[model samples]
Target: MTGPLAGIRIVELAGIGPAPFACMMLADHGAEVIRIERPGAKKGGPGGDPTKDILQRSRKTIAVDLKSAAGIGVVHNLVASADGFVEGFRPGVTERLGLGPETLLKVTPRLVYGRMTGWGQEGPYAQAAGHDINYIALAGALHAFGRAGDKPTPPINMVGDFGGGAMMLAFGMVSALLHARTTGQGQVIDCAMTDGTALLMSMIWSFQGQGLWRDERGVNLLDSGAHFYDTYVCADGTYVSIGAIEPQFYAVLREKSGLSAEPAFDRQMDPRGWPELKEKLSAVFATRTRDEWCAILEHTDACFAPVLSMAEAPAHPHNVARGTFVELGGVVQPMPAPRYSVTPTVAPRMANEQSDTEALLDGLGYAPDEIAALKAAGAVA
Candidate 1:
């Protein structure tokens, strides 16, 4: 608890994907997060190792069965002292459970209630079950991925889930918390993945509106349309990415890759010649290993780097020097980001090593006997 958000407290209704990731970011930056899990919920990381689940780190966990009135009462007690709350259930689910914004805001008037979903709170697809791909597809982002002749490639879950949903929710919660501290008011944040994904494409949309971009997938400059801004396979079957967009950087690319003497490469901005230039560049790149190309163009203004896999990324010299990744509980994972000069963030630890039900109930003003009775009644675990 050393970062800028050290004094803040958040209550997270335990969920998968975006909501958990948002809670993790808040907890990482020193917000004290209490994760409320259901009784008998699975307790392990993605690989069945509890410590390896990076999304669940840096939080205290308590099990409360929301079906019981006593369980709902426990949440209300926690909300009375919490600055914010988060949940990712479908629309109206929390309302049915008596844990909606209207119910919780009555307990703490300044609470920031964050809701995460795919299609959002109100829409034709709001109640339908969907995932990251479906949301980004509707946002016009999925159609912009992949090569010209190839089908749309799902960029895993990064674009919609972590990037759009979790990151946006975290930003909204912090913003709403700031406003609450100033005016003593609370509000709901309807953080839909579809809305967030669309917001993330603002720059691309601008390009299209200005007639600088085409609607096709791989024909845009930032996409894989430009020969100088794509990945290439080398002699060793390893890959390297090039992003020599500026004239100066592209000149360095042409020089270092021995393409300066070729007149065909001079037409860098000609879209009609991109296909031919890309073929020639691919052949040139295949003549050398990825490491060889890195040695030639990596340090130059060519904007080049080897396309390291997850296994190689942590071991890269630049990443190691910056402490970008850390090993905790025998698991290698990324560290909390966006450093603060004054209030440096503390290192994160494994979550839910043991239950905190008794301690939490005690702090909530519940007597030991009452806690025992609630547990006996199958209300808490």
Candidate 2:
């Protein structure tokens, strides 16, 4: 944990969904994130293996049964020593758990409290149970995907879960942390996945208002509307993506593919002619294997690329050159993102599960007898 946020300490109340995802991002960026997991919590939730969870990488874990007053006291103690805290419970759940903002903020006056939810802290659906698809469905993101004539396609929870959910929580927490540092004040960040997803759809909303986009799915400029801006299946059953948006880039694509003599694409921006041009381009692209098209246009600014699978992305030249992925604990996964120039980050140490529990408690100023009692009661794992 040695990056731009080298010294920031975060206390995370472990739960599911966006909470762990948010804390993971924080831990990745060099924050000292200490996760408080449930006593009997299991591994392999949404993110990954609890032991090998890349998202939970680089964080210290303390298991506590919140049903006990001592467990809640442990969280407050951690908060007193931390700069911030993040939780993903429903609106009143934290208050019921005796760790609400009002109580914790009194203990750690300068703490930034980040709260993540699907419907938000107070709303009609605030207490309802829903997943990423349900949240983004109301936000118009899901409605904008899929083929033109087909129903909307769910993008596998990435938009709402990771983008709107985890990413938004991270952004809000950082903002609150900055404010806390400067104003000597702490505030609660109410990060709602629904709101975040809706915010992400603003650009498409603008395009729709201007008549540049259609309400129908997959017919907008970036949503497979234009032939050059969509994925095309190659002769080898694999697919490649193209994005020759600008006229110059489109010209490069034509010249490289030996289609400059074709008149179908003479007028690029005419919506009336887009259908015919797309048909012609599709035909031309489908003739070659994905690799052949990559050889012709991948390196150029024709804005073309092969639609690499999950396994292929880490091996590509660009990803390899950028060191975009790292292998740890016999697993190859994406590296922590948003690299810093001055403070470099590293992968977390994988000691035995909860191996440092007693030592960590000892270091945190907990008395030896109290720690032994916690273990004796099976409240701490």
Candidate 3:
């Protein structure tokens, strides 16, 4: 608790994916986040090893069986102490659990209640089961991916889950918390992945509206439709990315790549010539190893970068120098971003299961016997 949000406390009803990621972001920046997991849920869920669940890092965890009244009571007590609360259940799930925003906001008038969902709280698809891909598909983000005449590509879960869902929830929570501090009133934030994903595509939609972008995928300038703004495979089967969108940078790419003399490259802005130019650039890039290309263009304004794999990214010279990654709890993971010069972040810690229950309860002023009775009643594990 050393970053900008050090004094804030959040109670997270631990679920999966986006919610965990949002809580992690808050915890990473020095908020005291307490994750409430189900008593009998599997350890780490799909994150494999609990310690290596990067999304669950930087927070304390308490295992509570919300089905039990005593467990619900425990959450109510935590809410009384917390400045904010986050849950990612389907629209009505929290209401059934007796932990809905209406109930919790009454306990803590200044609490910021955050709800993360794929389709939002009142949409027709709100109760429908879906994943990140489905959320982005509905948001019109999925259709923007992939080349012409190819099936739409899902950009893993980043666009929908993290960018749209979690990040938006975090921002909403913080903003709501600021308002709560001034007015002593709590509010619910309905963060839908679909809504956030569509927001992320605002610039693209603007391009389409202004007639600067085409509806087809892979035919747009930023969507790998242009020769200068796409990934190219190297001779060694590795890859590199280029984003020479400007004429100056494109000229530099032409000179460094020895394609300056090629007459076809002169018509860089001609839509009809893009496919042919892309073919020739592909052939040229395939002649060099990825590292060799990096050596020639990486430091220049060619808008170039070698497509480093996950294993290779942390070891890159620039990343290492910037301390972009750090080793914590014997695992290498990304550090808290958007560094603050006045109030720097503390190192992230691994999630501990039920290890903080007693201490957390004690901090809430529960007697030892009371906590023991809570455990005995199967309210907390």
lDDT winner, 2 or 3:
3
Candidate 1: residue 151 lDDT (0-100): 96
Q: Candidate 2 lDDT (Cα, whole model)?
A: 0.83
- lDDT of model 1 at residue 144? 95
Worst 10 contiguous positions by lDDT, candidate 2: 347-356
Worst 10 residues of 3 by lDDT: 346-355
lDDT of 1: 0.93
**Candidate 3 global TM-score:** 0.98
lDDT of 1 by residue, 1-381 (tens): 499899999999988899999999999899999999888878654565556788999888889999999999999999999999999999999999999999999999999999999999999999999999999999999999999989999999998998899999999999999999999999999999999999999999999899999999888798899999999999999999999999999999999989999999999999999989999999999999988888888778999999999999999999999999999888789999989899887698986556688899999899999999999998999
lDDT of 3 by residue, 272-291 (tens): 99999999999999999998
Candidate 1 global TM-score:
0.98
C-alpha RMSD values across all candidates: 1.1, 1.6, 1.1
Candidate numbers, best TM-score first, in rank order: 1, 3, 2
What ranges in model 3 sit over 4 Å off?
A: none
45-134 per-residue lDDT for model 2 (tens digits): 664466566667677888887888878887888888899999988898889999999999999999999998998998789999999999
Total clashes in model 2, counting residue pairs 3 or more apart in sequence or in different chains: 0
Root-mean-square deviation of candidate 3: 1.1
Task: Please say which candidate is ahead in TM-score: 2 or 3.
Answer: 3
